[model samples]
Target: MRLNTQIQGQGFPIICLHGHPGSSQCMSVFTHHLSQQYLTLAPDLRGYGKSYTRQRFEMKEHLQDLETFFKEFNIDECLILGWSLGGILALELALKFPEKVKGLILIASAARPRGNHPPISIFDYVYTGLAGLINWIFPSWRWNIETLGKRSLFRYLIQQHTKITYHYLAQDAVPAFLQTSGFATDALNQALRLGYNRLENLSQIHCPCLVLAGECDRHITAISSQETSDNLPNSQFYYYSNTAHLFPWEIPQTVLNDIDYWLTQHPEIFQSN
Candidate 1:
């Protein structure tokens, strides 16, 4: 699939997946801490970042690709950390291949396809659509990180580490975000048509689960996280104070600590199946 990936640290394999328009680099905050205890593999999902895409995007195909990636590393069982849209993929993976999943960690994930969400508002929809068109005309408009609601610290780090210019907004960032959002929407709609839903499949997941949500996130409310926890037979939930949808980026240490503690309490789960 020619996915752009970065592998660091050395221990049990931990696959980190980013959300829409977000590359693996989005999770770089946790690389140092996670690498300290486990091998970390973060990949830019196809159609985002440097990954190659053929035609249409398909969740099942992407899942299959990930399964192959795991097999290549001899990772029979490992932790899966997915954020936002990546969280959806994480749950799908666990559902489709429970034996390969050791533990599941979801950050700011939706329990099901949402309706009447803030981002779906008419203003945001029109604004984002216009912003996308503007980006198309002015590819260098992405440098304005302020519009992205990024904290100063995050903005500084991204500017210092990557060449993410304003143009990236129009050329890659914004479009990717919109595209993936649409992809998720379509997938969710199809699931509904097929009489399947996230809540409906939650009982099928037997793996230990850790669900984290941002206290201030309007996109995926804390209610979703709580419901996910309630649905999973073996799950624990935490809500980060003063955080938004970007909880992992905002508090990687806290998240890592929780994961470490959880794994410590469930060492038996990590053993080969």
Candidate 2:
């Protein structure tokens, strides 16, 4: 698959993968900063952005495509940062290509495949359903400049400078979430049907992993990040106190700082592990 990609900066490779409903553009915030120190490449995964392909959406296919894409760039090894669904894919890639993956930074991701059923909460269903309906009706009005500006002064400044439209939320954002959720649900069902717990094989991943969770993330709770950290011998966990599921977007500086510190502490591990 010809994945839509944006390459920037210069130095060691750092591939940024966005989650479902998010395109490479989502990583624009980090690329401008990270690119100064590393060669950052952010790609829109299949079925989400400009990647043109009609194949069935599956995790394996995504992994294979990324492997191929990296190889084509002669990227034998590099750091990887993935958010949400992208984080799950990054984990699978680290397992499948251990030698090629130097370090991993996962944001709001879980090791175990998520359950299909949403928790018993009418509000959850109602809110999500309403969001879906609004998305379908007006797929270009998900983010309102005034609203976001009021929510976070930092985000408002970014918006003012970038002028990123609310269309991202209405059109690409909501539909992307719905699609990935459905796909993950199906993958979970298939794993159960095959009598295999997908996460049972996580022990094979030995790379130095850093799992970051948002304290207020309702989708992937901090408990889930703790569970994932416990399963990996070489993993560390951190939680952003005032962040939500969109921690990376909300606190890019903090995430970058953590990653820089991690690289400093694990220089040898990235080079030789």
Candidate 3:
């Protein structure tokens, strides 16, 4: 299955993978920023965004698609940057095809993602529903429930996931979250149930890796992200305070700088390619 992919820039390939309930569009910021210095490829995994498929698929299928994506693009070696669920896929890719992956840049993602992520509560459902209604009714208005209700829903969902109040959500986040296909969302959760852990096997992936985490992340804890780095044979970890899972969106420049610095440190990744 050939996924719908976004390609940019003109140097060593750097594949950017999005999180669960996300599409290639979600990784546009990274693609645009890195495109100037690297070849950035962002693909909408099967069942998400423009690649939506009715046939059931899990992480295993997604991995197969990515492998095919590489062959389709004549990509023999590339750096990978993954966010949330995409990070898990990157680890799997590096493990399964170590020769193809030169390095990794993981953001707000975990190798051993929790199998039992909290479900959206009734309150979340109510608020999200209200927010939708409000947005529909006042499509032109920006200050009403469109802002308040959507932000409230974001906070509630994050609280359910992390038991902490996430103070901010970028305006784009709401639309991105809403655009996710229900089928894709359910498939990811099912994939998680089937298992996505790589903790014990992490040592097998020896390539350079840079793991970035949000200290205030509501979904994945900084410690968990750090643990992923710790288990890897060659990896570095960094955490940003007062940031949440969407820090890449909240502070795009900072995240980009961090990635740039790490890439500079591992010049071999590009030089070898």
Candidate 4:
């Protein structure tokens, strides 16, 4: 599969993978900021954005596509930045092809995800259900008010999964969510249900890793991210206050600076491939 990749800058490559229900566009903020000093390649993985084919993919298939993507671009080695589901893929990529991955920056992601068991509390369920019902009836996306207005119906659905407030949905994130293929979404969910655990294999990936988690993330809890860091042979973990799974957009500069600082700490990330 030839992924539609957004490439920018001209230095050591940093491959950016967006979360589930997202496209490379979701990472554009980071790409634009980081590209000033480092080359950034953000690809629309299969079944998302322009890569949508109505085809379902298993976890291994996604990995194989990434390997093909690397070959096509002659990317022998690079740092990987992944969010949520993309983080799981990044971990698997490092384990499967250790030499090709120099380091990993995980954002709101986990090695061992809960699969079908999301940690939504009873209050969350009630709140989201009522919120969703209200949105469906009144359609907040249609509101004329600027501050409270939403532009996409998908944003409403996303709020049901994450603890993020409705109006806080990042503009860039809405389209990425809307572009996601239903087949792709269903297949990934099925794959997760089958099992997405990687705790046992974290030791195999010896490269430097920086795990960033949202303190208020509902989907991938802070504990899961910390546990992933704990298993990794070499890793650092940090959590942001008042942030959820969408922290990248919520605090773009902070996330960018943290990544830049981490990369600077490990000069090996800039070595020629």
Best by TM-score: 3
Instruction: Name model 1 segments beyond 4 Å from true.
Output: 119-196
Q: Write the per-residue lDDT of candidate 3 for residues 120-195, one digit (tens) a residue.
A: 6787777766664555555424564345554554542332222112212233344556666777777777866787
Weakest lDDT window of 10 consecutive positions for candidate 3 = 159-168
What is candidate 3's local distance difference test score? 0.77
lDDT of 4 by residue, 47-81 (tens): 88888685566657778889999999898889999
Cα deviation of 36, candidate 1, in Å: 1.0
Quote the positional error of residue 105 for candidate 2 in Å: 0.7
1-273: candidate 1 lDDT, tens digit per residue = 656788999878888888755777666666657888789998878666667564665566668778778777777888888987788889999988888888888988865744223324465555455645654675544443345323222332122212233433444455455444444445545644664248878898888899998776665677777788889988999888776666665565677788888879988675775
Candidate 2: tens digits of C-alpha lDDT, residues 1-273: 767899999888889898755777777766777898889999878766666454456556777789888877888888888887778878888887888888888878888633222345565455455544554565434353333322432231122212233343444455455444444445434644664233666678777888888776666677777678778768989878866666665566777798778877877554643
Q: Is candidate 2 or candidate 3 better by TM-score?
A: 3
Q: Would you list the C-alpha lDDT of every candidate in the order shown? A: 0.68, 0.67, 0.77, 0.77
After superposition on all C-alphas, the RMSD of every candidate to the true structure, in Å, is 6.2, 6.2, 4.3, 5.1
- The ten-residue window of minimal lDDT in model 1 covers 154-163
lDDT of 2: 0.67
What number of backbone clashes does candidate 4 have, counting pairs of residues 3 or more apart or in separate chains? 0
Instruction: Return whichever of 1 and 3 wins on TM-score.
Output: 3
Residue 50, model 2, lDDT: 66
Candidate 4 wrong stretches, greater than 4 Å: 115-170
Each prediction's TM-score versus the true structure: 0.73, 0.73, 0.85, 0.82
